[model samples]
Target: MTNWDDFRLVLALARTGAIRQAGAALGVNHATVSRRLADLTRRMGGAVFERISGRYQVTAVGAPVLEAAIRMEAACLEGERRLRAVSPDMAGPVTVSLPDAIARVVLLEELTAFAQANPDISLTLKCSYAYADLDRSDADIVIRGASAPDEHLVGRRLFPYALAHYCARDYFDQVALPDRRWLVRRTPAQWIERSPCPEAPVGYVIDDIDMLHEAAARGQGMIRGACYIAESDERLIRIPGSKVEPWEDLWVLTHPDLRDAPRIKAVMGLVTEALMRSRALIERGETDRCRG
Candidate 1:
């Protein structure tokens, strides 16, 4: 009989197409992944994956196995969800996934208070740009910025998310309009064309939002960022002519199957209430100090 554990290896390897990546996803070492793949291949009496150039490609023999693994994985996730749905205990670990920026700027204080108030419920935060697979139980709760959430997820649209152009206060005062540039997350041309300063040069292209903000704060260039984050920073100030751009709605979501669990419900309620209380700041980027 094929071990379900081996099938998990197969799924990971097939999805990632590299031993190292698969191991990283599975939280195991590359050597362990290799050894397990070798053992599984021996049992199957043939190779499952063949390296073509640099990547592992699924062999003809492995295609059906991959399909079966996918089905089994779905069934396992469904069973887990069903079990959680009926769980009565409110005291246990609940993981919330969200972007690092949101955790830092908006929700951290509220989440900290939640942790303090509920010592019985252990809170785990997975902060990343990558969306967690709630259906797969990657997270019990998810806070995300999205145009619209998936049909499988249940959550509230907290507020409209917005971004605005900002630069270091000193930079804004000292830099000549012709000399200023943009620190951006995308290609220079893309940002420059859309920006108010179309003729401005690109100072830096950074993938991380926090790093981009830092660059802007250091007077490297102006940056377009979520209004709440940029406005909260004392080092930064809004560009003179730039306007806030409405992007998407901020959502707090969870899989329907797990939504009814006592801990999940409690966390969701608290988080939703907290976010709603800050809806004006999230939507318009106006804090008490900023308004003053």
Candidate 2:
């Protein structure tokens, strides 16, 4: 019988098509992967993969084995998720995945408080723009900005993600009308319809929101960003005639299987409440100074 670990090696190799990449995925070195493949070949009495143009391709004989491996892997992951779902104890790790901007500007303080309050539960945050796979257990909780979340997940839509144009106070005052520019993440066509200064030429095309915010703060040019982020920055001020545009809704999500777990429930509650508390600011950038 093939060891499950060896099967995993095969699966990894099949997925990545390179010994080095497969090793990296399995937390082993390329030599270990190669040796394991060699050993598997000896035991199976045939080659599982063929090298074709510098990439590993599964052989016809290996196809059935790969299919079985995939089934086994899925069953293992499901079993693990089921076990976690029924765990009554609140004293294990819970991972939350969210975008870096939201993690930094919005939920940092609240999440910190949650950590202090729940010392027994280890909290891990995966901050990125990429979505983590809930079905694969990549994250226990996810806070995302989307028009509609995956229907399989269980969670609440917190509020509309609002955005508006802003720039450094000094830049707003000092830059002449024609000289002023817009700092954007993409082509102006994407946001020009919503911009107060549609005529302003694009000054800088920055893809990272954090970098764009910094540039705007440094008086480089105007930027359109999340209200919750830019409105809180004292260095930046909204453009005089800018209107808040509603984009996708912000959602807090978790897999249905894990939703009932004690620790998952607790964390989800905390996050939902924290986000809801800021609904006004999130949905419309409402503030005393910004009130129409």
Q: Tell me the tens digit of each residue's lDDT in model 1 across 150-242.
A: 987997877787888888889856898888888878883565567777788887689898888888878889888888788888888887777
TM-score of each: 0.88, 0.88
> What lDDT would candidate 1 get against the real structure?
0.85
Clash pairs, candidate 2, are none
- Candidate 1's TM-score reads 0.88
Off by over 4 Å in 1: 19-47, 189-191, 290-292
Off by over 4 Å in 2: 41-47, 51-53, 187-189, 290-292
State the C-alpha lDDT per candidate.
0.85, 0.88
Task: Tell me the TM-score of model 2.
Answer: 0.88
